[model samples]
Target: MTNWYKSWEEFHTSLSKHQNQTHQLFRLRSSTSVSQRNKQEVHVYAWMTSQESGQGPANDFVQQVDTTRGSISRFGTKNVGTHNHSLGRRQFDNHPSNRRIDEPGLVELVRDLSSACSKAKLIMQHLRLKSGQYAQKQSLYVYAPIIAHTQSYLILGKQATLRDVHNLVAKLKAMRNGSASVEERLKARLREFCTQSGNTATVFIDDAKTAQTITLQSQQMRRFFKAFPEVMLVDATHNTNDAMFKLFSFMVHDVYRHGQYVQHSLMENESEECLRDAISAFKEFNPTWEETKVIIIGKDFGELALLEREFSQAKSFVPFSCKKKYLRTEMTKREYGGTNSLNTKRAEDSIDMMLKATTLDEYTIGLKCLFYLLDNVKLRAEDPVPHPKHTFLQYFMRNWGSCRQLWAAFGRAGIPHLGNNRRARDFMGYLKDILKSTMGLDECVDTLIFLQSVLRT
Candidate 1:
């Protein structure tokens, strides 16, 4: 039976009446939703249980269907193990059986006599790795709670040390199946994304001989794209998974006037063809893409060139970091690679002026500094040894210098200095911390979607 009450008093009275009449025990828990903006939501969960007067911690539970050898067993703790001595129960209440500070590994003769391998193997999850436990005392510097855990779950005597359990884990791993697969799993997850996002989510996964591309977007992402189609930032991160896949993200400014990266794609490489597939999918989803300004704040100018060719209508943005790197590299070579002449001295000081330029007036002064350093007459009589010249500067002036409107903030009237797509990098770090390890393709997508939903709600 279920009922909804408007007031807490009313609900409490009704719940008390049921408890008095049925004499059933119940537990109360809450789920909290906290936003990055510090907004909070709390949901109260109160339910009945058949465990009245149970002799254990209220939340500590072991889901055991049977004592079968290979049956699934879960020793779950509600909140990372809280201590409640008055209740005579605690989470993970396992203590080492050995009283000594040092113990030797089992000899071959003793190992032959031991027969608790199956029971011990049932406890450890990670391959040959023991769980880090809190040490309780100084005398038992070498004692492990994992041995106690194995004993509690399998009801075994003191027959296996930590090493014995690890050996068993290694043995079982050799006989186990290969790494888990994920194609079908990701497809199922994408289906769920579509439902949760009211069919606004878009997903496309294709496997080719040379490349694999998986693109995903949620309602929030689409909404951002629809609203702010004027500016788009594209970037890719490498070594994000075991398959050596690169994760790419597309971002736009949100209504709050903040950067919101709204899409993720896994690709085999940052090649033009691979990136084109991902960008075209997003471009097709939103009709206003042609009005958008595309920024490629990633490595590889070839990728940027491909984007320029693919979306010629959108204005391109070159990140300030790349501009600084090019300026510093070529100018430093001119300053230090040649003699201590007046030209080299002037070049050394000019590099400082260009880097610190802020406004249009200041930027012009910096350009004058570069012009002086780039003058071929100033760098005359270069050393016999390898030295800096105007070659790198000349190439840049003929090609990139003409595109100041794309790379220089001073050229854009109202636009602030859009340094790099750092928000995407920060969000990626948060996701990595959440998973704490390299996750499968399906699992990674599912986790990101869940995080998006949390932020949305």
Candidate 2:
């Protein structure tokens, strides 16, 4: 009865004013029952306030209170002990055994491993070094940081030192050739230098055949228009070897868009068929080429006629004629006292002058020099002076006789000879200035630009 009342709050409340003290007795009964079950505490209060207010039937209320009292007694006596045993069984499964590394420890371990790896790499490199290997090895391993520093100096138009290269090589050795290390370092260095200094490094590769193949595949004459669309300059020169003359057509390209000649090619020999073949080669490269786009053809009078017949739609500008007139003037100036005949000493003097002038200017100085030499020979012939077996006129005529035709062609094209001796001297001085200002691989491009700019001015 005490257990029944202990779980039944409605029964105590239904007792009215006498039930207040009975409710206190029910609480004492709940404490005693909880202690007898498992030494655990349990609270027994009104489950529903409406039931306590006598709103339901008494019999139904009493039955509900009895069922709840049985459920509480069974749970406290059986379920609570079973739940504690089950929690003990799952203790290992609920929690992990091993403790993970903290963030600071993991970071330190990584740093230590990296350091050890670097030291190992250095030791391996030291082991590999031998007295014999240094003499045979030509390939170098350049580093990124060192190359970067070298490029910085290069960008400021300064040359990289041997110390810079040595430092880079040392870094590369330390890296143990990590991820694309060599290629990445080279590419980065090239990109920085090429972008800032406009210089290209000439890397010598093992494949000579591949280099030749690339040159042939990249045929400048055939791909002239595609490579340089703006302005194309075409000219032809004749060369004599073993007293036989061979004509060579050439085309100049302005690739940098800086109004400077970048590339050249030998088109064909001196014949109508060869000229036609040259035209065909050009057409093969650019099928859409029209007569108007042909622009200019700077050639000799003989080739001029053939060029006109072949490319009638194109306009031809002759700069070599002025060159020839200049040469003839110089020749006449040398012929004041003597006739067209040249003496032995005079011929030798003339040859020396021609060779000297040839190195001074590109077109004019050469033509004028050759003209003066030839005129000196003509003066000696009129005088009829007997000379040795090896005469200047005879030597020049035998070896480089065809060069006269080259000069005449230059003159016919209206290209002035490097003017007078004073002008030639000035041009040489300009060339010397360029040579002085330019250094390293950049000299090639700089010299070309200097020449073009001088000509334009």
Q: Scored by CA lDDT, what does every candidate get?
A: 0.56, 0.36
Q: Write the per-residue lDDT of candidate 1 for residues 237-339, one digit (tens) a residue.
A: 6655656667788887676767776678877777776787788877767677777655546434457677777788766666666666655565445543434
**Where does candidate 2 stray beyond 4 Å?**
1-224, 227-230, 238-268, 291-301, 320-457
Candidate 2, position 134, lDDT: 26
Q: Against the true structure, what is each candidate's TM-score?
A: 0.52, 0.24
Each model's RMSD to truth, in Å?
Answer: 25.8, 36.6
Report the error of model 2 at residue 439, Å: 29
How many angstroms is residue 439 displaced in model 1 relative to the true structure, after the best TM-score fit?
Answer: 2.4
